[model samples]
Each structure stands twice: as structure tokens, then as C-alpha cells.
Target: MEFFSKLLFLHEVASSHGKGLDELLIYVHLLMASLFVGWLAFFVIAVFKHRRSVNPKADYVGARSHFSTYAEIGVAAIEGLLLLGFAVPLWAKSVDKFPEEKDATVIQIMGQQFAWNAHYAGPDGKWGKQDVKFASSTNPFGLDSGDAGAKDDITCLREKFLIPVGKEVICKISSMDVIHCFKLPRMRVTQDAIPGMSIPVHFKPTKVGDYTITCAQLCGNLHSTMRGEFKVVEQAEFDKWFAEKAKAGGGGGFE
Candidate 1:
């Protein structure tokens, strides 16, 4: 199963919740394959057994046995179990079990036509005031220069963001223009970035490495270029990186 998953290009599990998603995907594929093979076998048997040279009698009442009905009921039961027992619970956990802000590394992501603008609240742990009127090519976050919290804020373009491994990281996602999707395959995280709405998604990176961040939605002609990097590191390394950015004035402008 692991080999097949890798062969299918599934990303390695790098989060606590990622294994559950991987298992669910593998189970779904297994169920689908079983159904396909079962149907193919039945079709082949019917073709050979009911051929003219064999059972020439065409019975008016076809398939008098209750096996097909039982099979259909069984399939429905399995589907219901997969939905209620797995899918629904996973969704509820992802949407409702959000970590506390104080305990999580919080960041903001704003999506434009073909780029992701990432913002960190710095040591203050409070987001700065933003207004669309202040938006510019250089200042995509629209941060108000007069706001005190805005001074220490860090902003990065094209999705170069960092998070500490083994810590809960929450991202508040929004869009400046059309709808976009933020996808981190290794973390099993995907959320839509909608304009005028800020949606939160959280995950815990179990490994320290670079992960690909891609826009799963086609927002514009340049949507294919909407790619970013997510680097997971140790807590001390993450702190060092943040300190360096802070010392450099914390993403004062586009870079």
C-alpha cells in the first residue's frame, strides 16, 4: 500500500492528521477497485454462461436470485459508513478543532492574481490594520503605516513562509482579487481563499523540510505560476529566522 501510494505521487505524510487522510484515500481506491473487478467478473461470466451454444433458453424472468439486491444494499451500507464514520468526522475536526491563537504560530495569506502574499504578526502576536485603499504593487498587504502593530509586521511575496515543526500553525487566508485555493500536500491542508472573507486553516508539521505550496484553483491566465514554498524548521531555527527578518524591518515593502 505504501509503495502504491508513493507510485501515485502522493506526498509523504508530514503532519499528524496526514496519515488519516492517506488511509482514507487508500481505502477509497481499494473499494473502487474491488467494485470494478467484481462487476467485470460478473459480466464475463454472464457473457460465457448465457451464450447461444450453452444456455440457449432466454428466461423471461431474469436474475430471480436476491444476491444483486443484497449486493446493492451492502454497497450502500459501506458508502454510508465511509461518509459518516470517516469523512464527516475528519471534516468536523479540521473545521471545528482549531488551536488557540496563543499556542499556535499564526500567519495571514492574501492571494492575488498569480502570487501569494504571506504576513506574520511578528513578536506582538497581533495583526496590523489593513485597508484596501492602501494597497499598492509594493504594499500588497495594504497595511496602515500609522498603526503600531503594522510596524513589526512581516510580509513576503510569492509564498516564501516559514513555520516551526511540531507546533500548530494557523493561517488566515483571504484573496485580494478572485478566488484561489491554498494547498499543502504534505500537510494534508487545502482551503479556499475567498475575496472579502478570511478563512482559517491549521496544521502541525511533523517533519523539517521544504514543502510545495500551490494554488489549486484556476484564478487567472497566470494561475499556473501561482506557486510558493513552505519551510518547516526547528523552533530555534524558526526563531532565528524571524529575528533576522525583524531586524531587517520585517518585510517593510515587497521583496
Candidate 2:
């Protein structure tokens, strides 16, 4: 009952991007379960029927049947097709760049050894100029000074990312140190935040709630503690919260 409840909850919570993937996942699970049941039944029946005591003259053939060979081929083909047709596409959609849309909220995600630093693009929508050589307590991103767009940006190492529900959010992710993955299971998203590269994941929360963002990759000693969350709120409330954070002073890198 508990497992079924979780599955149902997942289905309900993930109606948008997760529905199709979940259906395909269920189909694959059912197929595998059926195969397991059939194998178990066949093996049990064979063992009982061909017992040494019951059939002292039983044929000791070790070779499998032609049907088994064809079954193996069929299973392989199905797995290949499912991976190529379903999983690959879902994965691509999750990590690919967000579509160009006006007024889209841009969030920068910086992954470090044991924390996630989330930064907003601010009102400019374009990151202020940065000098890569400038590295210190004040300039963590090593912004290239010549790139004039990065100056007024606000950044925060906030424990939770707050965004408006129903608004399209594009998260641009990068890593400061080693490779780390941004994983949001309920959102049907997981992508590597690699050093020197930015990956984007776009989504609009259908419901307002707090969702976890966990590091999927093992990076360091405290990798397990590297976690974060985001709150999906109404547009007006989100704007207020964003403003408060900005007023408090934000910190992180932008490009």
C-alpha cells in the first residue's frame, strides 16, 4: 500500500513532464515482471518434473531451446528500442537549453564542494561584465572586468530557490569545482553541472510547494550534505521574496 501510494503521488505530482515517462517506465516494469514470473514458473515446474528420484532416466541436455535464443534477441531489441525511442529523448529534453521566451526568469546555479549557490540574473537579464582573473572574497566568479554586463548582478547561496508557480523558469547550471549533478526527481530533471560549462533545464511548476534539489554525483567528503530546495509560490509573492533577497545582497557568478 505504501509503495502504491507513492507511485500514485508521483503520477499526480508529475502530470506535466513526468506523465509520459512514468507510463513508459511502468510498461517496462510490467514487462520485466512478467518475464520474471514466467521464468520462475517454468524453472519450478521443470525442477519438480525432472527430479532425479522421479525420473532416473531423464535426458541430461544442457543446451537451451531455440525459443530461448529468439526470446533473448527479442528482449534485447525491445530494450534497445525503448532506450533509443523513450529514455534518450526524455533525457535530452531535461538538459537541453530553454526555449527563447520573453520575460523568462533566469537563475544561475553554481555548484561547489558542498553547497549550491543560486544567483538571479537581476533586472538586466544579462550578467554584468566579469574579469576571470579577479578572484577574492568579493569576486567569487572571477568575472572578467571587460565584460560590462556582470556588475550589478545579485547572488545568493540561499538554501532554497523561490520561484513563482506557473512561470517558466530557466536554470543555467555550472560547477565551481568538480562535477556535480542537479537532481530534481519530482520535476523529472537531472543534469550534470560541469565545470566551465553551463547546462539548462526549463520547467514551470504546476503546484506550489517545496521541492528538493540534491546532488546526484559523488564529488567530495560531504557530497551527501550538498542539498538545496526551491519554493514554488504565486507570482506576486515570488516577486516580493525575490526583491527581499536582492535587497539583502546576492552573491555568485554570472556569464
Candidate 3:
């Protein structure tokens, strides 16, 4: 599967569910390859059997056979099985069957015209009070200054956020202005950030390393440059960083 993934130009899979997704991709590709070969072979056979030299007159009723009908049915059946058996189940796991909140790292991500913003709940695990009224260029999250929860909330604007490796990370994605897609390639996670709607996607980063966060949509002129980052570090390292950020009043890491 690794070789096949590389052949298909897929990035390294870091999320737990990534393997399943890769497998599904390979299956779909194999199906397509089979169809391509079958059609090509049929075309060659048809041309050879109906050549002008072999048959001067065109047959009004072309070769009539149940083979084509059966082949079409078989192809549709395979496609249906792939969707119902594999794709739907994987999508359900990502969007519906979430890990417990206490055991997972929950972060709120807001997409703007050309940048990704992340907001963490700090040590309390309680989100800060936010309102559209308080939102501004400096404070993209609209974090209420007077709210106690807001005081310790950590915000990273166009900056890297940190999460411990081997833990489920749930990101609630929303758009500050235009529609955007939050995509983590290595993690095999992609979720749309739509205005007035917070969509959630989860992934467990198994490897400890720096991974990129990119806007997968053509949000604006700078959409290609809309990039953020995150680090999957050891638990102890994440704890230290979290505490330091909290002590510093959740430093504004606007880049």
C-alpha cells in the first residue's frame, strides 16, 4: 500500500483512519484501471471485427449481445459497493463517531480570506465567550476581554498550534468571511469552513513532527499562500508549551 500510495503521489499518512482512506483510494483506482483496459480492448476488437475491408456494408443492427449489459451492471455494482461499504463508513467515523471530549484535544479554527486561525480553550477546557460585535482585525475570534474563559484562551493567527502525538484532535472549523477548506494533508483530513456554521473534523496524529495546514479552496487572490502549521509533539512538551502560553496570557501569535 505504501508503494501504491507513493505511485499515486499521496502524502505520508499520519492519522489513524488514513490507512482506510488509502485503501479505498487504491480500490477505486484499480476499478478505474480495469474499466480503462476493458474499454480499450473492446474498442480494438470492435474495430477489427467491423473494418471496411471485412464488411463493405454497415450492419443496421450492430452486434447485439447481453455481454455489454452485464458488464455495465457489474461496474455499477462495484461502484455502489465501494460507496456503501467503505466510503460511507469512513465518513461516518470522521464526522459522527467522535471520541470523548475529555480525552481529545478540541480546538476551534476560523478561516479568513487568506489565513487560518486557531483558538484553544487553555487549561480550563472551556471556550471563551465570543461575539460578532467584538470581532476585529486584531481579534479574529471575537474573544470577550471580560469573560474569565476568554482571559486564558489561546489564539494563534496564521501561526502554528501544538498538539500531543497519538491523541485524537477535534477541530471545529468555521469561516470568518469567505468559504474555505481546512486541509491537513498528512493527516488526511479535510473539512470546509463555511460562514455561520462550525463543522467538526477529527484526526489522530500518530507521528511527531511539523505538519502544514492549508486552505484547500480558492478563497481569494492569496489563497495559494494561505498556509498555517501545527506540531505534533510529545505529551510532556505540549504540556510545557501549553502552560507557558497560558502564563503569558495566551500570547497573541499573529503572523
Among all candidates shown, the one with the greatest lDDT: 3
| Highest TM-score against the true fold, candidate | 3
Which residue runs does candidate 1 get wrong by more than 4 Å?
Answer: 55-57
Q: Please, what is the TM-score per model?
A: 0.94, 0.79, 0.95
Q: Quote the positional error of residue 151 for candidate 2 in Å.
A: 4.4
Q: Which stretches of candidate 3 lie over 4 Å from their true place?
A: 251-255
Deviation in angstroms for 122 in model 3? Answer: 1.0
TM-score order of candidates, top first: 3, 1, 2
- lDDT for each candidate structure: 0.86, 0.71, 0.88
Tens digits of per-residue lDDT for model 2 on 1-255? 336436546534432566656766776776688789978997998899889898888577865679778878888888887888887887677435455656567877878877877777665666765444674334555555455455445676636778787777788888878999998777777789998888877876678888888899999999999888888888999888876765554334333
Q: Model 3 over residues 116-154: C-alpha lDDT tens digits? A: 888999888788888888787678888888788777788
Measured on C-alpha atoms, candidate 1 has an lDDT of 0.86
